[model samples]
Target chain A: MPAIQVTNLHKNFQTKRKAVGLRGSLRSLVRAEYGTVEAVRGLSFAMDPGELLGFIGPNGAGKSTTIKILTGILFPSSGQATVLGFVPWKQRRQLAYQIGTVFGQRPQLWYHLPAIDTFSLFGKIFELDDRETSKRIAFLAEAFDIADLLETPVRKLSLGQRMRCEVAASLLHKPRLLLLDEPSIGLDVVAKQRIRDAIREMASLEGVGVLLTSHDAGDLEALCKRVIIINHGQIVYQDKVSALKRTFLTSKLVEVRYARQVAPDFHIAGTETLKVAKERYGVKLRFEARQTPVEAVMARLSEVGSVVDITISDPPLEEVIAAIYEQAERSEAAIAK
Target chain B: MNEYHPTRTPAWILLIMRELKFLLAVWKTNIASAMEYRAAFIAQMLGMILNNAVYFIFWVIFFDRFRDVRGWELSDMFLVFGVAASAFGLAAFLFGNAFYLSEIIARGRLDYYLSLPRPILLHTVASRSISSGLGDFTYGILSYLASGYCTWDGFGRFLCGVVLACMAFTSFMIIVHSLTFWLGNAAGFAGLALNAMVTFALYPVTLFEGFSKLILFTIVPAALMGALPAEFVRAFSWGALGKLFLGALLLLGLAVLVFHRGLRRYESGSAIQVEV
Candidate 1:
């Protein structure tokens, strides 16, 4: 059986409609209005065991809603979902033993308590044997490099340190399936890289099936083998992460710092000046990687002024997903017309 | 990777034991959190005790003038207030989350408990501890002594009354909070209902008559939290104790049923909340 199987899943929410100002508020108190909001409409997908799937979507695109359903946190309005052969909502307790979840916005650890306190509590919660719990804690502490942090109160640790411990706590049971929602959110570049590395290592070591949702494109590129792009509660794209990047990673964003200020009109062909700071002697440029060679673009940029430093990288994942959303919107509009 | 092993034990006793174990774990965490702010915790507890003492003073003054209101003397009033406060305090101290269920449900804070592998209502109710309730618990013992119930049997009976009162108060709060599933943002209404229940519990049942008395014994069950338990403690009667036990069980059943039914329609909140 697949690790996760969701078919024709739908979730509808009835939200109160509020009017503006005091009159409307008083009016609503006497006679309130409610509207149905379809959060996830017919979301269907299946994940094989040991698969690293990147679930990507813009905010309010039903990413978290789908995760909640899969984790048995919220019941679907209609249709069916099974995780590890157990129906999520109906057999939630049975399914919980095999799965681990880390929600970035929600801290599972007790704020005032040490991470070790929570680990011990979770040990009782999962009903692990004393020896087994101790062994797993020791192993995870080393694996996540949180040996020192285990003693620190969760409120006292830095975001990165706490996140590392959070991931470790979820893995104490050696779960077969792992679900992480925006695990690298608010982390610096170095912290994000460390987290990505730790997650990839853990997944490979335990052969755990991972379904990760992240807005950071680097997280997808570094870890996921397959990517699912969702918008408006529908799947717009699903394919190999490498393939998605290859098709859409057509542009490169380049930043150049000059020793002296360059002319306002000092521009290069096949390139767009995204930002120019005359005082700082810095210019940000964007160009199609396929259309303009990096060597040609560099040659032209050097002509403007003596280059102090230069950096080049692909455009962020949000831009790529935005383009995909735009393409999907256009197609949807065409179908509507 | 380990195969998925189901933890669904068929034995009802074992299930209750496991749930209890989880409850203890959550309570430990809550108490530990409260202790982290030692000065504030002490202050809250002391403040609550003083507040309850002030209310008892008014009862003492009233009894001094009128002697007794429909056979309820100063001693009975002390026991009534003691049982009500202690029962409420015990429930609040251990299952503090019960008092805030409506707010939690309205704010979609159930996400955390639902995601875990435990009984959702039990976990939610025991997630936090009310520090101020320590005062109520202390006052309960002191009031029982002050009411001149100094015998071993009286002490034993007071303990029973406190247990019944706690169960009744906790279950009643659960029923009121469960309304959020059907009526969104029912926090304001739940608070008012809770206040009414507390107010009725603090007074003598003799003060109420006819439909008001019926409502108290049935829907609101303020007597279950205060008068009936106090009456049973003061004068032992199997009939009154049986009624209180049966009533508590019914309220518990109603709470569990209402909460589970409401869980079906729970739409999680969109607002970003971080406890840390």
Candidate 2:
């Protein structure tokens, strides 16, 4: 059976609305007004068992709201969702025993206690006896590389270290699926890379399904096979991650620093130089890989001057996703017109 | 992974045992967390004791000036205050989150409880310990002793009264706070309700007669929590005991039902909150 199945899920929030200033505040006190916010609108999707699916969206796009509904933390306004063959809202407790969750913005570790204390507590919460709990803790501590850090109070650990402990704690019960909402958020580059690598390793080793939601597209590129891009509380794009890259990640950027000073009029064909180093020894350029071959660009650069340093990469995923967002918005505008 | 779950046992008993185990572990962790700031814990606990002592002194002075008001003497004040303080303190210490549940709901902290595989209301209410509750409990016991009704039977009744009052008080707070699910951010209103309950609970039932007495019995139910319970402790009557028992059970049932009803309408906020 699929690890997750959501059909036409809808969530609406009733938000209090008050006008500005003293007069408005007094009027609201007498008869408060409220407005409706459709946070998630008719979202539908399914994930095969053990599949690493990326649910990517910008802020307020209903990614977290959908995840919350799937986890049974928030009830949907309408529609159906099942996790591990159990209806989420009705069978939340049963589903919880079979799934784990990590909310990056909400740390589950007790701030004043050591990570191990929370881990031990979780073992009990999941109904593990002392010996079994100890064995499981050792296993997870090793898996998440949190052995050395577990004894330190969560308040004392760095954000990255605390996050590792948080993830490890969630896995204490050996759940079949892991739902992570923005797991790499607010981490430094190295921390983000470490988290992604560890998550990938754990998923592969245990065959645990992962449904990850993030605004960071890098998280999708590094970890997931299939990707779903949501915008304005709706899915705008869904496909294999490779397909996303092939269709939109067509441009390449290169930065080269020459050992010797290059000529000022130095120009390469079919490539646009974005910036020149103040010392005149380095230049940054971009070219569509479709239009200009990377091998040709490399040969031309070598022909220009002796190369000291070079870096080649695709445009950051944010830029790529932004492009899709613009296309979706324009199409939506057309439909409205 | 599935072997850890024992499936052969009777379902309801197993469910109760598992939830109880989880509760114990959570309570243990809460105490350890409180001890992390030992100095602050001690200070808060002692400060509460001092605060309650000052309030008790006011009663002592009032009774000295006026010997008895409507057959309610200084001793009666002691027993009522003892029941009220001990009950409030016990509720605070055991279910500290009940006091600030509205704020937690408003700030989205309930997410932590909902994600776990345990009873949400029990876990959320019992996850924290109030350091000062110990002090209040101590003060209550001292007040009960000074009332000169410290017989073995009277003490048993006092203990029973405290338990019932704690149930009523905590469940009342839970019901008030659960309104946050319908009314957005009801923390301020909850605080007002708490103050009203505490104020009305400390006064003698004789002080208010017609409408005010009606308010105490039904609306705020302070009479049930303090005066009625105190009267039962002073001399146990089957009728009074049954009334207090039924009242506490009814309030507790209402609390659980209201909270679960509110849970359906819970609109979790995006306001960033750290689980401490």
Candidate 3:
């Protein structure tokens, strides 16, 4: 059975209108006005056991709202959701024991106390036996390589160290599923890499399903087996991470500077000249990696001039997602037309 | 998805015990955290004691000049402060977050408690500590002693009053704080209401009568938190003790009901990622 199943979920919020001045405030005290906002519009998705799925979206795209509903923190306006075959909102307390959550921006640790203290307290909260709690903490500390930092107060730990502790603490209960919202946010590259590795290992070793939300493309490419992108409260794209790259990651960006002036008519087959700076004697090219090999492209560039410098890189995940969003908009406009 | 299957829910007794155990563990962490800064901890406790002492001195002078107010002696005032302060102190020290519920709800800090497995309301209240409350509790003990009502029976009554008073005060604040879930940001208003409760509770019950007295014993319940407890300590009466106990229970039940109802409208704030 799938670890999580959400069907046509909808969430609407009513926010009060802010009064402008003293008169308006006094008037509002008598009778206030409100406006309804649709945070999640008919969203539907499911996740299988041991699957690493990336739930990505831009700001205000309902990513957090959807997670909140699935975690039983917020009720859906209309629809059905079950985590581990139990209705999330109805069986919140029961479901909480089976699922672990790590909000990168929110630390669950007691700031003035060591991470071990919070871990011990969590044992009581989850009703774990002392022996089991200690064993699990030790295992998690070793798994996340945080044993040395366990005694350090949360306020004294570095951001990366703290994040490691946060994720480790969440896993102390041996939950069957993990819901991570921006778990690698605000961490350095090395820290990000370590977290991704730990999560990947946990999913593989324990068969724990993970639903990770992140804006970092590297996180998706490195950890997630599947990717789901949302925009304006609806799913824009959903598929294997590899399949997404094979389909949308069509072009490779190349920037080059020449030793001398280049011709205005500079062009190559299966390649597009994005820009030609005459004053700087430089040119930028974009081409399908399949159509034009990197070696062949560089060989061609060298023929044109004594290449002073060259750089090649695949299009970033943001740009790829943006292109997908553009395609979606165009299709939507066409349907409207 | 599979059909709804009924798993054996734990017995209510066991669940309550687990919740209590979790609360005690949280309190341990809070106390340890508070003690991390030894000097600051000492200062906050001592500072509250000194502050409460000033109020006692003011009452001493007032009673010295006028002798008594409406058949109420200075000893009665001490009893009032003793009961109120001890109750306030015990509630604040143990369930400190109750006093800050409005701010927590307004700022969306409930996310932490909501995500945990424990009972959300109790967990949120027990997870914090008010260091200065220790001083208030000490002052309460001293005041009760100074009233010269230090007999064994009197001490037992004082302890009972403390429990009832704390329950009334905590539940009252919870009711006021729950307003933030519906009113968006009611922190300032909640603080004002709490200040008003404390201000009126410190005065003699003889000063109020008719509708004012009824309102105090019912809606605002300053009498329930203070006058009733003080009256029980001063002159033990079964009727008054029953009312104080019953009032505390009713207010607590009402507060819990109101808070859960308001949770339906809670719109989480976005600025709750930082440490509390």
The numbered model that scores best in DockQ is 2
Tens digits of lDDT, candidate 1, A252-296:
999999999887766889999888888879999999989999999
lDDT by residue (tens digit), candidate 2, B1-276: 555855587889987887788888988898898889999999988898899999889999999999888898999999999999999988888889999899999888889889999899999999889989978888888889999878899999999999999999999999999999888778888999899999999997788899988898777988777898899989989988898898899999999999999999887767766666
Report the CA-based lDDT of candidate 3 relative to the real structure. 0.88
- DockQ values per model: 0.52, 0.75, 0.56
Q: Which residue pairs clash in candidate 1?
A: none
> Which of 2 and 3 is the better model by TM-score?
2
Top candidate, metric TM-score: 2
Off-target runs (Cα >4 Å) in candidate 3 are A18-32, A255-266, A274-283, A289-299, A306-312, A330-337, B1-12
lDDT of each: 0.88, 0.90, 0.88
Interface RMSD of each: 1.8, 0.9, 1.6
Q: Per DockQ, what order, best first?
A: 2, 3, 1
User: What residue pairs clash in candidate 2, if any at all?
Assistant: none
Give me the runs in candidate 2 sitting further than 4 Å from their true place: A20-27, A30-32, A258-267, A295-310, B1-15
Ten contiguous residues minimizing lDDT sum, candidate 3 chain A: A15-24
- For candidate 3, the per-residue lDDT at B129 reads 90
Q: Which TM-score does chain B of candidate 3 obtain?
A: 0.93
Tell me the docking grade of candidate 2.
Answer: medium
Share of true Cα-Cα contacts across chains kept by each model: 0.63, 0.77, 0.60
